[model samples]
Target: DAGVTQSPTHLIKTRGQQVTLRCSPKSGHDTVSWYQQALGQGPQFIFQYYEEEERQRGNFPDRFSGHQFPNYSSELNVNALLLGDSALYLCASSLVQGSNTGELFFGEGSRLTVL
Candidate 1:
């Protein structure tokens, strides 16, 4: 029961730098989704990955992408980050279970601050 976990709990970097956040899904989950939450706002879905491919995506730009491994862990990569990118990078995992809509479980998140 590892639940969802993220690395670099707190990160600080200048604009234009790149950052990679990691996540491990809860036990027995096959799908992982990435979300971005800014101050005072709900998490927005960046993308959802299954079968090692992106199953769905939100309105985020190309700079935002992710990968899901066979073990159900995932990583989110953001390149040429901008000041606006400063936010809580949350990784939510859910068990597909053949459901039309899945439930999400969240991690503590990797906090990114851009200067």
Candidate 2:
């Protein structure tokens, strides 16, 4: 019954550094979506993974990459980080049936601070 879970609740990195954040979806959820939430802003969709493949992506730069494992877990990798990249990285899980994406359950998120 556990919902999505993320690791390294908090982290710090410098500009040009690289970071990877992990996520495990809730039981029975097969799709994972990653988002970036800046201070006082709504969560911005980064990408979505289904069936171990990237199904969609947002406007983020190429520095952002991700992978979905067979177990339905996922990882978000950001290379050449910038100060603007400092934000809460969120992982949301859902069940995808046909063209429908059911309700999303989100994790507490991994906080990244880039200096």
Candidate 3:
């Protein structure tokens, strides 16, 4: 009965540093997607993982990557982080029950502060 969850609710880093964020999908969800939301801007899709593979990716740099585990949990990793990377990292979970338009449940998000 749990919903999607993200760790390190807030993080701080400097340019050139690498950071990893974690997420746990909602109960009965098998698909996990990662998004970045800058202040006053809409969320931008980063990537999505299904069946332990990266099924789709958005217009993000290669430095942004993700992994999905067997338990439907996921991780987002950013290497060589830049000041522009400062944003709220959100994790959304969807059931994908034979349809692609299912509603997505989102976590509170992990806020990243790059200096």
Candidate 4:
């Protein structure tokens, strides 16, 4: 039973560049959520994906996009990256019941640096 796992672990990018981060949910989890955490701030919700569709989104700009595969894995794509995009990208897995998402299991996260 592996838990939520994210890839790239750490990466660096220049402004205007694009990056794609991947995530695999824990067993039996069907929903995946993406979050961004600044140096000292808590995680801010980016979006939620379920059944291969984006079910919810946060206040991020249109440059942020995502996709969920049928196998429950997900990918977060950030385009036209800015310095402000430097942060820890987190992947959380949960089970969606009706309109609510149950407790989330988070991965170690991918650290993105924009220079």
Candidate 5:
């Protein structure tokens, strides 16, 4: 079974630029959630995608958006990135939505460094 995977394990972006990160969910999984983990902190939920639509979302602003494909893979798009956007963007996959007690398998993450 293939576990979650993310692209470009590291990234460098300047302020005001836009960036897109990718994620492939675990095998047999159907739900994907995006999170932003700042340095020295736990991840904060960005949004969740299931059935190719946004099933849920966190407190993130409009600048943060995402999309999930029929194959259960997903993408996170950050527009007009800010310095504060510098963080590890993690992608987590679950077998089902609300079936487990929020236990998630995370990818290594796409590290975005903003200047």
Candidate 6:
């Protein structure tokens, strides 16, 4: 079965620009979450989507948004990006087991460079 996939493995943008990243979840999975990993920091959760709705969000600014489709795929969009927004954007998918003990399968991240 196919695993999580992210698009445009790499991207280059400048300040005040907007970017959109896509993700397709693994087969049989239903939840998709986005994370941002800065150069020297751990991944920071951006938001999560479930059943076509935003189920949870992290400590990110409102400029970050997302969407979930019926097939369990998702997208992350960042507006008015800043140089500091440059990072490895990761997309993770996992089964919605109604608990927090499930495993999250991550895709090769989309590297964004702001110049």
Report the number of the highest-TM-score candidate.
4
The lDDT leader among the candidates is 4
RMSD of 1: 1.1
TM-score of each: 0.95, 0.98, 0.97, 0.99, 0.94, 0.96
Q: Is candidate 1 or candidate 5 better by lDDT?
A: 5
Q: Give candidate 5 misplaced runs (Cα > 4 Å).
A: 97-102
Give Cα distance to truth, residue 59, candidate 5, Å: 0.8
Give stretches of model 6 more than 4 Å off.
99-101
Evaluation by lDDT, superior candidate among 3 and 4 = 4
* lDDT of candidate 2 over 18-115, digit per residue (tens): 99999999999999999999999999999999999999999999999999999999999999999999999999999997887899999999999999
Question: Judged by lDDT relative to the true structure, which candidate is superior, 3 or 5?
Answer: 3
Better of 1 and 3 by TM-score: 3
Candidate 6's TM-score: 0.96
**Model 2 global lDDT (CA atoms, 0 to 1):** 0.97
Q: After superposition, how far is residue 102 of candidate 3 from its true place, in Å?
A: 1.5
Which order, best to worst by lDDT?
4, 2, 3, 6, 5, 1
Ranking by TM-score: 4, 2, 3, 6, 1, 5
Residues 1-115 of candidate 1: C-alpha lDDT, one tens digit per residue:
6888889799998989999999999888888999999999999989998889999999999999899998989999999989999999999888776744478899999999989
Q: Clash pairs of candidate 5? A: none
TM-score of 5: 0.94
Candidate 5 lDDT score at position 50: 82
* Total backbone clashes of candidate 4, pairs 3 or more residues apart or in separate chains: 0
Model 3 clash pairs? none
Per-residue lDDT for 36-72 in model 6, tens only? 9999999999988888998888999999999998888
